[model samples]
Target: MIVRPLALCLTLLLAGAAAAGDIRIKDLVEFDGVRGNDLVGYGLVVGLNGTGDGLRNSPFTEEIMANILERLGVNVSGEQFRPRNVAAVLVTASLPPFARTGSRIDVTVSAIGDAKSLLGGTLVMTPLNAADGQIYAVAQGAVIAGGASAEGDGARVVQGVPTAGAIPAGAWVEREIAFDFAAMQQLRLALRSPDFTTAERIERAVNRAFGRSVARMEDAGTVVLDIAATGARSPAHALSRVENITVEPQRKARVVVDQRAGTIVMGADVRISRVAVSQGNLTLRIDERPLAVQPNPFSPGETVVVPRTDARLEEETGTGLAELAGGTSLSEVVAGLNALGVSPRDMIDILKSIKAAGALHAEFIVR
Candidate 1:
């Protein structure tokens, strides 16, 4: 069982190593300021079949509904409403980099009140605000929930999440965030996974692509780019030429285990030192059975109940202390462990014990 997975991982590692010559720079790092901004807003969804929020239970829904009605020139200041066809929701979207006015972006709507579902509902115009407390975009469209729900008198069924949905091209961009990506003299590339070796390789790759020392490593995670030295008209032009340059990334050896799922994942760089491991488990079982006692039917004082239990203990055999030589590769380590013939759960315990004994040469992580 373990040999197959380790063999698969070994094959994948070898395939990846063969293609480690170059990776696109854009895939390796993030260009500073070229990112999206999260926008959120409060909104209302109408047109539901009595599955919306109960006004009595969620008073805020009533408040927002009344506010919306009043804003639309309907004078219902003191009127009470017990409608079950409207829901209060939160609208969220991301303003992509270089978004212009009139550009459309997708938005997600989630129920904030005790609404049963947001399906078959239309969102009224809602203003999305940024972290700076300024309205950035307005989202309004029909919500297409990814789930469905059905309920009878005594039972209910749901698939996916009915209280949340999305609308593609739902929000129209009204204003653009101020950023000077073109006029920037220097640009910084932030590595997605910060590593000194990877960052240095990226710096070297970028310089080699430009045929000059245009990029330099600032830290383990950041690489500074001299846009002026690239002799490009703008920083955008300089970045276009640099992003295609690929460099192989470096990562630390790691082994992660999910105990609840009995899953173990190892990196190609994982290794093991010489050690011996013993694997076994003791299992105990108990069965309860109640015995009934009765006197002769005609002359019975009373019927009596007696308790009885059966207990048994068993230990697995054929598993004992097995000595393993030093494993310089992930496959060897996995093959060594697989020789014990234990389940994944038992493998987790053995790996933990090996790590505790300082015989595991990789970082051990448990989830």
Candidate 2:
């Protein structure tokens, strides 16, 4: 059977049209100032199965250990010691908005020293502090490391990250952030992906939902809301009533390509202008054949080898220009590209070239 190179095939499918729908307001924007706060603390992980930090190399670990021991009424001053049962670590957690005192939150612990692993370990009492350097919560729990490590005398093996672990509901809130969510006069909805069209749509949809002009576009990224206009008891109540409102969000034409994974994604808004694309392959092959040269039977002359190389060039047949009409929709643009009949990598090159030539009518992003 003769193998023929792929030819440009114009296979346009009408069913490939972009879907039309509206998205919820909550999915499109973030509630300004109603977000989590980052909390971090320096702590220690103990009760390890001989996989802790080397006390000598990590002097801070030894110092913290001594301090902890002294706090427990066990004095070890001026004593040199080596132990592999404890590791210094950094504990982190996000203090959610409106978190009440005595509420439990999850915490993550990561080795800050030369600790081998955190499996089967327990994090000591660590005070998590926010940006203000005030302790907001305290965390203490058995560590559930995400990975495992094993070693013998010669070799060792590890899977995932053994130096980091987490404890579910490990931290208990001790202080509450002062935020009057109920006494707010106004609220702002910040777009996750800020766009003038999207923000305007959100403002309009929110106002329409409440049957009044309660929401107004502050900027391309923010929508200011009149909390009193909703006639709700609190800001939370006003938000709850309008968060489910759906609106058609606008998106600009975009083409994203991940060359490492050979993946290409085109937004539904993408379009292509009338252009002609030609794709063909030119292959060059070289083959080496060496021959041994031997002198007449038992001659004194040294044997030698002769090198021969065969080189050839071939251009694939069925190469021609394919014209893509001005595409009004994403399906048409995709059909035009699919007509090129080239591999994804080749398609990426063609896209880049088209972008460089100002032919592609979209934001070309390559990752």
Candidate 3:
């Protein structure tokens, strides 16, 4: 495959330029108390096309089925029942901030039993609870399985996760969190990626927007905002004004490598010192042939077998020791590396060796 050095250089150059632009405070930090809550519940999924769990294999499924029947005033005590259309499932949903009662939210359903698939299943009325053990919402809807499955007596094929599914707008909120956003006197902004320079910039940006010192950098990861000093109506109003302020955020030099995909990503600040590198590949080949030797016609009785093998070691001609000049910019670094005429997978190894030699001045991460 032909390697496009110019395209790679341009991509790195553009990435460096993009990082220099000012970003909004909202994108760099999160409001401390403004977040979503996770809700989970154990429930049952029904109406499957014979893909439900085996009652004998999953005794929990049988127990839950009996409980549902009894709750519906149907006497199932000591009754032997085997159903192939029901499965036990775990329902999960996120309660968004400021969600009001009667509001609808989406939910995910995952089969916890040995059900082959959850396709065409409907979740029963399941009460979702939060960490406080309080019922927050109820979930019940038709499941949209992520994949499909086909099976027969001899073979089976499944794509994606057929046992997990999702339902859009499948739950109604029954309670609201007790936090009063309007009554807050102060609010903290938590940085998604902590950086002292970024936090200071955010503090300055917010204070500049309010024309006063209403924001302070508590640490590398936190910036506190004084709602009363902003002269805004409430904490919500103050945050609305502060979050829109723009500031240039600082980032560290980092090189990320995804080995499976042969992808290499480098931040704008990544740097490298002048270094020489050599790369090559070795291939080992082996072949085996079994020969059967038989006695002459109408002569001796036994047959003999002989084994033959061939093996060879070969080395591919690679680019000799190449010099990578120290780079002051991302484009230069990418160009220098590309000049070696290697594929991305090979480039990853070169980078690793460069880091080990103390020539690569950035964090090297391999996934």
Candidate 4:
């Protein structure tokens, strides 16, 4: 059956319409020196219902427990301990820029043991620290697990990631990062995807928006903006106004192929040179049978037995060699392949062969 319209069948992929809604200058370019820091802490989740870690497999669990108790003024140095109601977890969160003490933030907790699940668990007061080993916040809250499990006798079922959970506003900030964001005079708009063309576009867009030559393309990946000269209060306010400006981002034309999934994706600009393709398959088969013969009971053949084997070969004529024509447009390329009347799986191989032949001008990616 025909799947495409006759008149509009030619493949035409083009850049979509420009984005809407003002993207804040804060989103477009970063104040050269302002960014968040990542914090991580090792902690424990308790109050589980018979699904915590096997203390034998994760001995460090006990070590941390002993340490916690010591900090809380409990002397357990000589006590033998084993608990199945607690699971060791790694707590992680990002400290946002300009965060102040008393502010709340979310944290993620993931089991670091053989715990079956972290459901109905509560994280203890765990100090989250940065790479500098200084505590910035403390996390503690009831875990809202996204996954769970069940087991009874010999049957069990599970869903989602029961070993990982998260807490909303679970951590309290105790310190502020030392940064004078409002004092900066310059900002850098880093292109998420670095391209010389895109960088120039961003530089031009920023300068045009403010009617001043405040932004300049420093390199393919970075654009430097003169915030002080842009007439804004400071770096922070300047970014707030400029980040919403729009600039077209450029990207190279590419063809992505998932070999395992037999999927092909091509960009609008992907082009191909003239080429011819041919495909065919060969098959060979063999059959073998074994039979045993026993001597007659009355025969003087000592009741000997013998074995016989037989084999045969058969061949089926393959769908003769097929040829595919080179195509200029994406639609033409697909139609040309369809002319060969081969399944998509076979078409994938043909595309690969064409790429190896240097006839496919676009990037041919095999994922």
Quick one: RMSD of model 2? 4.3
Per-model TM-score on C-alpha atoms = 0.92, 0.88, 0.92, 0.81
Each model's lDDT comes to 0.86, 0.86, 0.89, 0.77
Q: For residues 1-367, could you state the per-residue lDDT of candidate 3 as single tens digits?
A: 2332212221221234536689998999889889999999999999999999999999999999999999999999999998899999999999999999999999999999999999999999999999999999999999999999999999999999999999999999999998988888989999999999999999888887888999999999999998899999889888888888999989989898876666788889889999999887766677878799899999968998899887776777876899999999898898998899876667777889999999999988889
Error of 2 at 129 (Å): 1.0
Report the Cα lDDT for candidate 1.
0.86
Ranking by TM-score: 3, 1, 2, 4
Over 1-367, each residue of candidate 4 has an lDDT whose tens digit, in order, gives: 1222111212322222223333444455555666788999999999999899898999988889889889999999989878789999999999988889999999999999999999999999999999999999999999999897999999989999999999999999998988877767777778666789878878888888889899888899898888778998777677776777876566566677665565667665556666765565433333344455667878765543454444333333446655556665667766676777666666667767877888777777678
lDDT of 2 by residue, 84-195 (tens): 9899999999999999999999999999999999999999999999999999999999999999899999999999999999999999999999888888899999888888
Regions more than 4 Å wrong, model 4:
1-31, 282-331, 335-339
Residue pairs of candidate 2 with colliding backbone atoms:
none
Off by over 4 Å in 2: 1-17, 282-318
- How many backbone collisions does model 1 have? 1
lDDT of 1 by residue, 1-367 (tens): 0122211111111201212356788998999999999999999999998899999889999998889999999988879778889999999999999999999999999999999999999999999999999989999999999899999999999999999999999999998999978888899999998999999999888888889899999999999999999999999899889898878888778888876566788877888889998865555667889899999979948888999888776665755789888987777887888787776567777889999999998888889
Clashes of 2: 0
